[model samples]
Target chain A: SAVISQKPSRDICQRGTSLTIQCQVDSQVTMMFWYRQQPGQSLTLIATANQGSEATYESGFVIDKFPISRPNLTFSTLTVSNMSPEDSSIYLCSAECSGNTIYFGEGSWLTVV
Target chain B: SQQGEEDPQALSIQEGENATMNCSYKTSINNLQWYRQNSGRGLVHLILIRSNEREKHSGRLRVTLDTSKKSSSLLITASRAADTASYFCAPFSSNTGKLIFGQGTTLQVKP
Candidate 1:
């Protein structure tokens, strides 16, 4: 099992500002992903944080808005740039471990003011 | 497109009662996974059932997958107030190598 931890558990930022959420895994993981959950909504995959390369983003999400950095197998970071009220949401970091089970970190709660 | 839509958008049940949530997908999948989130917090993986498997159990949680019907169900028996949360089903398609999430079922277990 992998223990994934995230930082900045809760924060309120001003519009136009950016916030970076950090994720650290206890063990090396092959796959790491970022997801967003807006108010009263389910999670939506933001991007796949790939180590040593650019992240793979899903449709409706772009690198310019959500830049991701996976420096190693155990650490990754996601930045929500040029934030807006629409960007206020819970950002989650997850890693697929134990073959089939995926573990998630206690998400970062960001509220844009 | 490996997402599953959850049924009964919201459910309200008393403590000790059983809560069942259903998910239906549009395409075939290799496996189906269930996750829970409390008060919009991070997700906790509850259980996973492979397409070939019919049923799986973990503690008070039971998951059943019916590939022929392209649907799955999650049953939480003897639920408690702590079990009040949103439940989601993620269908994994080997073709995409990822899981897509749909709007989840919000279960409110009243104490």
Candidate 2:
């Protein structure tokens, strides 16, 4: 198991602005992922953060909207650009550790006005 | 696209009773995992059952998987008020590291 942390545990942002959520892991991990949980709904994968390379985004999500950066094994960031009320959701960062078990950060709850 | 769907979107149960949630997936998977999330919080991993295994237990939680039917169930015994949260089932594909999450079941345990 790994200890994961995210910054700005909760934030209220204005529309047309941007907020970047940071995720830090206690140890180096092979893969880091970003997910969004819409209100009253399930999680949707936004992208996969790969160390030293471009992130792989899922369908319905774009790099321009949700750009990701994984400079090292233990750190990554996801920025939601031009925020809107519809973008208000709980953003979670996760890592796949040993035995293929996944661990998640406490999550960054963003509320766009 | 999402791969799993859990039945009984919302459940209310008394403390000390048992709560069960069911999940069904579309494709074959190497492993399926159950996770719990408090309102407005991130998810916590509960347990994982591999395709080759039928059932697994951890503390008060039991998970059973049927690969042939592509479905799974999670049973929580002696539920408590603190157990009130949403539960989700995620199936990980062996080929891609992607994990498809279910719609989730909201369980409210009354004290």
Candidate 3:
């Protein structure tokens, strides 16, 4: 099992500002992922945070908007740049430990005004 | 885009009643997992059923996966008010180790 922690639990930011959410895992994990959950919706994978290389983002998402950095096996950061009202969502960080079970952080709730 | 779709987006039942939720996916998967989220907070993994397995049980929760139909069902027996939350199904890809989540079903277990 993995214990995940996220910083800035809830924040209200103005439009056009950027916010960086940090995720820290208790143990080194092979896979780390970022997901976004809009109001009253399911989680959408933002990107896969690779340890030593660029992140792999899903379709409809790009590095320019959601830049991810995975400096090591236990730490990663996701930056929501040039934010807008549409970017208001809950961002979650999850890590896959062992092989099957995935653990999630409390999540960072960002509200753009 | 997510790979699964859950039926009965919302459910309301008594605390002692049982609750059942179903999920259907479009693609082949290595395993299917159930997760519960409380009021839009973090997600807690409930149970996981591999493609080769048909049914699995964890305490009061029972999960069944049918690979032939690409569907799965989760049953919570004798639920409590604490069980009120949104439930989601995630299809895991063995090749990539990625999980795709469905919309989710909101269960309201009134005490």
Candidate 4:
């Protein structure tokens, strides 16, 4: 199991502003992923952050809206650009460790007003 | 679109009883995993059952998979109030390593 930490556990931002969430893992991981959970809904994969490369985004999500950066193997960041009220959701970062099991950060809850 | 769907959106059970949640997926998967999440927190991995395996267990949690039907079930025995949380079943595609999560079953264990 990996000990993962995410900054800005909860934040309230004004519409049109941007919020960047940080994810730090205890050790180097093979892959890192970002997910969004809307209230009362299932999680949606936003993108996969690969170290030293551009993030790979899923369908219905674009790089412009959710830009990601992975400076190293143990750290990654997801920035929600030009945010709106609809963008309010809990953003979670996860990493795949040994045994094909994935561990998640505590999550950053963002509320866009 | 989501690959898996869990049955019984919500469930209320008494402590010491057993709670079971079912999940059905759309495509082939290398493995299926169950996760638990407390309110406003990240998900915690519970157990993983591979496509070749029928069942797996960890502590008090048991998971069974049926690849022919593309479905799975999670059973929590001797439930406790601390077990109250949302349970999700995720299937991983070996080709992508992306886990597709289900809607989740919210279980409330009453003490």
TM-score per model (chain B): 0.97, 0.96, 0.95, 0.96
The DockQ for candidate 3, computed on C-alphas, is 0.83
lDDT of candidate 2 over B1-111, digit per residue (tens):
337899889999999999999999888788998999998888999998988999999999999999888899999999999999999999887688778787799999999
lDDT of 2 by residue, A9-87 (tens): 9999999999999999999999999999989888999999999899999989999999999999999999999999999
Candidate 2 at residue A69, lDDT? 97
Interface root-mean-square deviation, each candidate: 1.0, 0.7, 0.9, 0.8
- How close to the true structure is residue A87 of candidate 3, measured as C-alpha lDDT? 98
- Candidate 2: what is its chain A TM-score? 0.99
Q: Score the docking of each candidate (DockQ).
A: 0.82, 0.85, 0.83, 0.83
Alpha carbon deviation, residue A74, candidate 2 (Å)? 0.7
**Consecutive 10-residue window with the lowest summed lDDT within model 1 chain A:** A95-104
Task: Itemize residue pairs with steric clashes in candidate 1.
Answer: none
In angstroms, the error of model 2 at A95 is 0.6
Candidate 1 achieves a global lDDT of: 0.91
Tens-digit per-residue lDDT, A1-113, candidate 1: 67889999999999999999999999998889999989888888999989899999998999999999999999999999999999999999998876567789999999999
Chain A TM-scores for all candidates read: 0.98, 0.99, 0.98, 0.98
- Model 2, stretches more than 4 Å misplaced? none
Models 1 onward score TM values of 0.96, 0.97, 0.96, 0.96
Top-down DockQ ranking: 2, 3, 4, 1
Candidate 1, position A103, lDDT: 83
Q: For residue B6, what is the lDDT in candidate 4?
A: 92
